[model samples]
Target: MPKLKIEDLARIREQARRATLLREGAGRVKITVHLGTCGIAAGGRNIMTAVLREIEERNLHDVLVTTSGCAGLCSREPMMTVEVLGQPPVKYVDLTEGKVKEIFAEHIVGGKIADRYALAVGSERVM
Candidate 1:
C-alpha cells in the first residue's frame, strides 16, 4: 500500500467526524441500507452507492447514510430505511439504483415518504 498523505488523512478525519455526528443524531435524515447476504444478491450495494452519490451531488451534509444487516424481510432484499427527524421511519423494498435515487430525492431531501416504494412506515415493536 502507498504511504498515507496529508490530504488523505484530512479526508479520513472529515469522514470520521461526519460518522460521529450521525451516531450522535445530529443529521436531519438517516438512511440505513440493508446489506445482508440476500440483500447483496439483490443489489443492495448499488442502492447504497446510489444514495451516497445523491448526497454528494446535492452537497448535503445533514444526511446520514449507514448500513445494517437483514431487516427480517428476506423477500424485500435490497431494502432501506429512511428516517427523517420528527417523522416515522419508512422502509422501502426491492430497490434498484433508479428507485434509490428517486427515494433520496423525494423522501430524503423533500421530506415526503415515497409511498409507492415503501413497504411500511414505523418500526416493529420491541419486547
Candidate 2:
C-alpha cells in the first residue's frame, strides 16, 4: 500500500468529483466506447485512452464518457457512440486517436456530425 500524501489525496478527490459529475450531471451528453473482447483486441483500450485524453485536454465538463461491452459488430471492433440529450445517437467506427480527436472537435464541441468516420446515424447505417 502506498503511504498517503496530501497531493495524492487531493488528486484522488478531484478524480472522484469528476467521475461523480460525469455520472450525475444533468443534460450531459454521453459518449460510449465499445470494449468487447474483439473491440479490445482491435485497440479499444487505445480508443478509450484517446477519449479520456481529449476530455481532459478540452476540460469537457458536461459530457459523460463510458464503456459498453459490445455493439455486435466485431469486425468494427473499436467503435464509439455519441448521444446528445434529445438527438439520435451517432455511432462512429474504425476509430483511431486522430479520428477520435476530430470527432470530439467537430461533433462533440462544434455540433457538426463528422460524416466520414461515422458508421451509423441513429437506426440507419451509413458505412
Clashes of each: 0, 0
Q: Write the per-residue lDDT of candidate 2 for residues 1-127, one digit (tens) a residue.
A: 8999999999999878776875565646789999999889999999999998999899887888789988988898799999988899999999999999999999999999999999888955669
Residue lDDT tens for model 1, 25-102: 688888899999988999899888899888888878799888999999999788999999899899999898889888
lDDT of each: 0.88, 0.89
What TM-score would every model get versus the actual structure? 0.80, 0.79
- Which candidate leads the pack in lDDT? 2
Q: How many backbone clashes does candidate 1 have?
A: 0
TM-score, predicted candidate 2 vs. hidden true structure: 0.79
Question: Stretches of candidate 2 above 4 Å error?
Answer: 1-19, 23-27, 124-127
Pairs that collide in candidate 2 are none
Cα RMSD for candidates in order? 5.4, 5.9
